[model samples]
Target: MSQNLGLRLCLVVLLCLSGCNAFNGGSTETASITPAGVPTDDPNATRGLAPGLTNHGVVDSIALGDAHEAVLSNTSFTIHGKTTVKYSNGTLRRQGERTARVVNPRDRRYINVSIYTQNKIRSDQKSTNNSFWSNGERVLVALSSSQTNSTTYQHFESRDPQYPILKYHPQKERYYTLFQAVDTKVINHTTNNGTTLYRLTSTEIADSAQLIEYSMNVKIAQNPRNLTFHAVIDSRGVVHEYRLAYTATLTETNPSTSVRVVSTTRYTKMGSTTVDRPSWYAKANNTTPEPPTTYS
Candidate 1:
C-alpha cells in the first residue's frame, strides 16, 4: 500500500508540467465563447483572454508542492533548445519531431499537424507512429514499434561488457541501477491564446529536492514528494514537448515512507515516443477520427 501511494505520488509529480508549484493564482472565473470563434490553440481562451500569446521565445517559471513560495537553488540545465548528442563518429543526433492537434471545443473542430524538424538525420530517424485523438482513445496510430540505432545504442550501453546494463528479473521484479541521486531545475515559457503564463518565478520557492524511484511502464519516477515536468503545450491543451526530472535513492525502503520498489526511479524518460493521444490526460482527449468529448 505504501509503495502504491508512493508510486501514485510520483506519477502525479512527473505529470506536472511547468512544475506543480506554478499552478497557483487560481480563480473559478469561467468564461464562454462561441464555437465558431473559439481559438484553436487555447482550450481555456474564452475564460477572458486574447490571442498571440504563444509567440516564439517566451519564458515561464514553474513551481510545485508549495505553490510558488521560495526560490529554488542549484538549477543545472539552462534549457535552450532540444538536447543534442554526437556519436563517436561525429554523427549528430537529436530527438524525434514534434506535432500537435488543435482542439476547438466551441466549433467541434480539430487540426492535426506535425511540426517539421530541421535536422535531416533527426527527421529521418524520427518515429512516425503518431496517435491523435479527441479523447483518450487511439485516433491515429501512424508509427510502428520499430527500434532505431539510437534505441540500440542505449540497449548496448546497458549490456556493454565495460558497463554492463543492470539486470532485471521478471518473476522476481528486479533490475540494475541506471542513475544516482541528482537535482536540477528547468525553465520554459510559451504563449497560448494570448495569456502570459509565468512559471517558477522569483516568488515561487523550491521546497525540497530528494531522490525517488523510477519506472518504465509509466515512464515516471516513483517520487511521492517532488517530481518535475516540462510541457510545451499547444493552444488546445495538447502537449508538444514534455520533459520530466527527478531523483532515485539507493535504499531498501525510503526512510521517509518505508516503501520498496527494488531500485529507485531516476530522472529519465521511459516508454516509446509514438503519436498517440496525450498519455497523461483523461477527459481532454486528443484522439483522431472521432471528435473528442468534453464537459461543457
Candidate 2:
C-alpha cells in the first residue's frame, strides 16, 4: 500500500480503537466488583506494620498492579508524558512531550484536544470533531458531530509507548498499559467523601527484558532502570491519579546519553463534564454533547 493510504488506514484503525461512539472505545468497561467480594480488612488498623508489606484486602481484590482500565469514560481527564535524552556531559540531545484533555469521551459532541512536540517541533494537530490529521492534513470522517461526535485521537509522538511484552499487552493506546506486568505495594491509604483511597508504589520490578528491542535514542520503556510508579486508586479499582518515572543510560550515541521519562495522568469531574467546542468548530457546531450523568 502507498504511504498516504497506509497513514489513512492507520488513522481509521486508531479511531475505532479509541472508543469512537460507534465502537464503544475498545474493551467495554467491566463492571466494578460488588461490595460483597470487597475485602473490608482495613490496612490502617495495622498501623504498626510497614506500609507496603501489609496486604490490604482492598489491594488484593482489585489486583492493584494489574492492567485494568478504570471505568471513567465520558469524564474529564488529562494525560501527559515527557521523554528526554541528554549527553553524559549534561547537554540536551532530544526531548519529546505530548498531552491530551478529553471533555466528554465517547460522546457524539465533544472537544478532545492533543499536542505533540519533539525537540520543540510540533506536529500538525487540530481540535475538530469527527476529523483526523492525515499526513499533515485534516481529514474528516463521516462520524457525525451532532449525532456521534468522534474526535480526532492521536498517540504520543514523543515516544512509541511500546514495551517488550507485545502479545501479553497489545493495547498500547491505553496509557495504563504501561503499568502492566508489575507488582504494587500499598504505601498509604486514606478516605475522603466516604471513598477509600490507596497510594501504591513499585520499583524496577516490571517483567521486561534487559534491553529494549526497538528503542529510539531514549531507550527506557522496555527496561526502565530505577522505575518509580505511584498510583492513587479508589476502592472500586478506579485510578484518580498516577505518576511514573524512570531513568536509563543510552550508550548508542557518541558521548553516551542519559534518558529520563516521566508520565502523569489525572482524572477529574467525571460523569458531569462538558466539553467546550473548539473555536474552529464552535461556529459550525450546532450542538454539544454532555457527558452522561453516570458511566460504568
Candidate 3:
C-alpha cells in the first residue's frame, strides 16, 4: 500500500471495516435556490444542476444505506471534475488529490486524469504520482499494480477513470456514485465562478459495504467506523460535491490500529475540461494496446 493512509488505509480495508465522525447538523429542510444561473462552458449546466435530474419530493429524509442510488440514475452527472482524499493513523498520515476529464459523460473511455499522493510519517513526507491519459490514439497507464513490482507503465486501448492506479490500487472517484452516509442540512451557495450550488451535510455512520466499493481488488484494509459526510446536491438531484471523513480498525497490526480518513469529491470545469497527452504517455504507449484492466 502507498505510504498515505487515506488511500492505503481506506482501500486496504476493502471488505474489512467501516464508519467515521463529523458535525451532525443535517435537517431534511429544503433551501430556496438563489437565481445565480448563467451558462458556463458546460453545455449541460444550470446552476449546480446538470441535465436529467428528477425530484423524489421527499424532504427531511435521511436515507442511510437506502435509496441513495435512486438519485444517481436520474442525474446527468459530472464526468469532468476533481476529487481529493486525506487519511491519518496516529503519527502516520496521507493526503492526495485527483483531477479528471472524461471525453463523454456517457462513456468511460478516452479520459485524462492525474493523482498526486504524499505520506507523512516520522516527520517526513514522501510523494508518488500516477496517471491515465492518451498519447495519440492509444491510452497509457502509469499504475503500480498490487500484483506486480515492475516499474514500467501499462498501455491500454482506452481508459476508465474508475480503474485502479498507483501502488495502493485506488480508483478514481466516479461522479455517478454517492455514499448514503449523508443526512444533510440543505442550503444554497454560489461558486467562485458565480454558479449557484446546493449543499447537504451531516455526520457519517459505519457502512462496510459502501467502503468496500472504495477498495480495489488488492489486500484487505480495516473496517471504517463512525464516518461523517456532507454533499452538494441540488433539488433536481444533481450531486455537485461531497466529503467523507472517518476511521477504520486495522487488525494487521498487533494492538488493533485505527486510521483516520477524509475523502472529498466535487465537480468542477465540467464540459470545458479536456484530457491532454502527458509527457510520459508516448513512452508508456510504446506497445500494442493490451487488454483493458478491471477496476475496483
Q: What clash pairs does model 2 have?
A: 19-25, 108-148, 108-149
Local accuracy of candidate 3 as per-residue lDDT tens digits, 15-91: 11111111111322223345343333445433223222212111323332123334433232323223323335245
**Looking at model 1, which ten-residue stretch has the lowest summed lDDT?**
163-172
Indicate the worst ten consecutive residues by lDDT in candidate 3: 15-24
Please report, in order, the local distance difference test score of every candidate based on alpha carbons.
0.23, 0.37, 0.41
After superposition, candidate 2 runs with Cα above 4 Å error: 1-70, 74-105, 108-176, 210-223, 282-296
Candidate 1 wrongly placed segments (more than 4 Å): 1-98, 106-128, 133-140, 147-196, 201-243, 249-296
What would the TM-scores of all predictions be? Answer: 0.23, 0.50, 0.52
- In each prediction, how many residue pairs overlap at the backbone (N, C-alpha, C within less than 3 A)? 41, 3, 21
lDDT of 2 by residue, 139-191 (tens): 11222222224432332121111211101111223433334434566655666
Report per-prediction Cα RMSD to one decimal. 19.2, 12.6, 10.3
**Model 1 lDDT tens row, 1-296:** 35324323432332221111111112211122222322335665324111212222112212121111111111111111121222224343322221222221211111121211224544554332222233222222221223332211101111111110111101011111111122322133345367333221121213322223222222332433334443332232212223333332323223422121211111111122122334423432232222232223
Q: Pick the candidate with the highest lDDT.
A: 3
Model 2 — TM-score against the truth?
Answer: 0.50
